[model samples]
Target chain A: MIIQVQDLVKRYGDFVAVDHLSFDVAPGEIFGLLGPNGAGKTTTIRVIMDILAPDEGEVTVLGQPPGRAKGQVGYLPEERGLYRNLKVLDTLVYLAELKGTPRGEARERGTALLERIRLEEWADRKVKDLSQGMQQRLQLVAAVIHDPEVLFLDEPFQGLDPVNVERVKSLIAEWHQAGKTIVLSSHRMNLVEVLCDRVLLINRGRSVLYGPLAQIKQAHAPHSIRVHAADLPLDLPGVIQVQPDDGAFNLTLVEGVDPKGVLRELLDRDVDLRAFEVAPVPLEDIFLAVVQDEDESEEGVNGLA
Target chain B: MDWRKVWVVARHEYLHSVRRPGFIIMTAIVPLFGILVLFVGTFFAGQASRLGDFFVEQFDSTSQRIGVVDRSGYFTPILPEYRERFLLYEGESEAETALLAEEVTTVLVIGEDYLETGRVVAVTKGSGFGSAAVSDSGSVRGFFVDHLLAGQVDPALQRRAANPMSVEPRVVSSRGESQGEGAWGFVFTFVVPYVLSIFLVMTIFISSGYLLQSVAEEKESRVVEIVVSSVRPIELMSGKVIGLGAVGLTQVMVWMLSAVGFSSGAVALLAVVGAASIPARVLILGVVYYLLGYTLYAILMAGVGALGATSQESQQLAGIFSMFAAVPYMISGFLFANPNALLARILSFFPLTAPTMMMLRLPLAEVPWIDVAGSIILLLLSIPVALWAGGKLFRVGLLIYGKRPTLKEIWLILREG
Candidate 1:
């Protein structure tokens, strides 16, 4: 495991911020830490990053303590900021140096990263002079200035416009291709779904779901198929209902019915079908469903108590 | 502690603070302003001296005369040199007549019992208050003293009797060497330390403020988390303390040098730094206390900074902690009056007030070596404790946002740490 967290618990006074949380990330894989606001995701990351100590249990990065492994770990904290008084390039170089990068190499890489972000012209300008999106890009550059082996980016796309978000997404993709382990934490399910290989969904400081992204989507996938067809029959065998969905028809199949059989029925009816596919649940929908389930279960436990 | 990282952070903080417009302006403007005041002062002083010399030339003693009526038989024959200014007469009526005619500025009557009672009366035209009265009285007294010892003593002996004594003090060392600095030496002994104490306190105030401001700025900007991820809280705090202390020392050195430079060029005030020598021990001790004192306050202000969520809040919190440093200054009068007083000694031993207290007391009197050693030892001991406590506060407080911690929470944080 590149990163390991076992039975981790952290608290602030009487409030438990993380409770018995456990997960691990493999090298060269994108791991998603998905949760709502105040769900202990930040606290968990802080403990993993060794910014905050865990009240109970253990965390090890690269078979060592977090502090020892910090040099190899790059972190972009959820609360994004840089030295506003420092120049853009200088801030990146300083952060890189803090991670034990040599000044000459840090400066060289920092300049290259600035150029990569198309921020070369703004390198000499103070960070405060940059627009919010530009500063966000610069912060991203700072996070990876040392080109660490493992990167933890918390809400990396926050405060970024779509173009910049795409820019950041491509950078993350490039890092993953270079075989760097990454723990991408965000509540934006679509981005996480597109980028993460495995996920750990948390709510109220407890894991609500954990597994491979494809397996989770498969398990949560609805019993339906999306078909783009005109003149589709509502009263077809093994078809319980039909509903219009995004310029297509959603066929809710009966229990134990194969989706392929529904497509066969549509073809026999001579329906002009433009497209057909099994409707996998959107990660956003799965996220909401799991969160709602957790809340209701919690209420049930509270009611019983 | 990661010495290299500490060094890096210190270098960064030092450069950052010195580069700030606020620090630059404070360091530059104060000395420039001091020079301006000195030049302007020298100009006015020159003009006043010239005016004074003109007045002296116009009103020299040749323009005034005094009428004396001698009943004591002491003025049987007026001395030839006194014949110009002193006009002798037989009775008080003749002297009064000369005075009414303005032949003399005053009339003096030496009584018949002058040999027994030593009484003399002077009459002058009444003007509410004037320098004329002072000059007339001086002339009459000189006439009486000069004649009182005419044949009984030598002229030099009479002159010595009239002038009395001029005191020149020499401080003797244990090795039997004596150094006399006269009045300027005394002024320097008292004034130098007083000024040094003020400077030490100001440096502490300014440097500790920078530490607090630096911490508060990092926290307020939400940049502390990223920085702390790569280094410990203690390292960050130590770096800021060292860096800002250097900046404060730089500022004070500039001011001191500018003071010497400006004072040297002036006419009337030039003796201040030139004639008064600061003891080597005081200079060394001043630096020692400044470093220790700055560290103590820097840790304190850093803790205060950690507790505050905003720079304004940190400043408010600092206002309370600053009262501790201000205690020495507030009671400076008592300290000056009695340098080795019990209160002064007690304050000197306290880490918060020690630097300023010692600065105030060191020059006023010979502070015992034991007390100096004891206070320094106490200050040395206090820093680690402060760092521990400050680190606890800093570790937890730097992460909290949008609200100040309550006393109970602070206690809990310390306890937990």
Candidate 2:
């Protein structure tokens, strides 16, 4: 594992920002840290980067205590900011130098990275002179200027448009192909679904779901199928519920029943089936389901008390 | 501690701050203002002397002559110089008539009992208080001395009687070292150190203010997280303190050098401060105290600044320490009267007040070597402790946004550290 967090607990006074959170990121893979706003994603990343101390539990990076591998780890915080008075290239160089890169090499890499982001012309301009999108790109360059082996990017796509988001995604892909570990924290489920291999979904400082993205989706995959057929029977064998879905009828099977059985039964009833396919739940629906489940449970506990 | 990272941060901070428009303007303003004051002072001094000469020339004009009525019987002859401005009249009524006609600016009447009582009166142009003629009274007295002693004594003896004596005072220290002549030397002895101490305090505050502002900016702008991810909080704080200290030093050096370069008063000031009461040790001590004082305050302020949610709030939070720095100045009268007083000794040992208090005291009195060493040691020792506490506060505070920490929370943070 490139990054390992175990039983991590952090609090800000009365507020528990990260409560008994445990997860690990394998080396050379993209791991999504999925959470809603105020869901302890930023705080957890801060702890892993050694930017904040955990009130309890332990975090290790590169098989060492947090912060021991300083130059090897990179972080782009959720709240993006840079020295507005500094030139674009200079800011990147300074940040790189702080991570132990010498000035000459840092500047060279900074220049190259600026070119990669198409900000080479703005290299000599002050950061304040750059527009918001330009600054965000420059900030991303700053994160990777030192070429660290492991990176933690919090909400890296928050302020980006689709085109820029695709640009950043491609950049991440290039790094991933180069065998770097990435812990990407974002509330953007669509991006996470497209990019993440493994994920840790957290809600209110506690883990909601954790594992390989495929396994979690497989485990939470509803036993349902969508059928685009005429005169579909509302009460089909082994089907518990049916609902209209985007010009198709979604049929929910019994808990132990397979969608193949329902499909065969549909064919046996001689339904004019135009289309039939298993419906895979989107990560967004799963995220909403898990979060709402946690909220309803907490409310029940509160009412009992 | 990574010295390399610290150096990088320090260098970046120094360059960034020094290039700021605010910093450049502030740095230039001090020396520029000093030069302006020097030129204006010299111009006014020259104009004042020229105005004095003009007034004398005007008073000596024929239209503004003095009428002297000699009623005393002993008067045989008036001197040649006295004849230039004074016209002897036979009676007071005649002199009074010349005064009313504006032919004379003043009229002097000698009483008949001059030998016994030496009574004389002056009559001038107006009947109100401004009519009394006292501006050129010294010349009139000189005239009296020249005439009175004319044939009574030898010329040299008469000259001696007229001018009296000239006193040249030289101070000798307890060690029998000579502090060069006159009251100006003694005045410089107190004034120079007092002024330098004020400069030291101002520089420390200004520099520490830069540190505060720098920390506040990083926090407010949300850049600190990225920076701190590469460097330790202590390293960041140390770098900023060292860097901004240099900035303050640069500012003070420019002002001091400009003072020495641009004005004759500063040259005379150095001469008196150096040749008279102040020894060279004061300058060395001044630099040492400034470094220690700046580090101590800068670290404390870095913590306080990080705790604030905004730069303006940080400045407001810093006001308490600012007032504390002024304590020595507030009680400066006692310091001047008794540099080795108990209160002065107490302030000298305190880290916050020590720099200014000791600067004021060093030139004024023979401060014991133990106190000097102790104060410096105390100041030097307080810095690391401040760095520890401040670094902790700064570490957590940088990540805290939107809300300023409460007193209890700050205390908790300190305790946690």
TM-score of each: 0.82, 0.82
Candidate 1 CAPRI classification by DockQ: medium
User: For candidate 1, what is the lDDT?
Assistant: 0.81
| DockQ, all models | 0.62, 0.80
> Chain A structural similarity (TM-score) per candidate?
0.89, 0.90
* lDDT, each prediction: 0.81, 0.82
Candidate with best DockQ: 2
lDDT per residue for candidate 2 within A145-180, as digits (tens), equals 899999888999998998889899999999889998
lDDT per residue (tens digit) for residues B1-417 in model 2: 888888888888788778878778867875776677556645564453243345555654334577888878544367886687778888889889988897777887778899899887878776634234443455666667778889889999877776566445565655877755454444335555556567767889888998999999998999998988888898998899888888888877775565445434533433333335444566578778888888888988998999999999998998887877788888888777888999989999998888878877877778989899999999888988888888888887888899998999989999976
Q: Taking the tens digit of each residue's C-alpha lDDT, what string does model 1 give over A282-305?
A: 787998987888779989999999
Model 2 chain B worst lDDT run, 10 consecutive residues:
B266-275
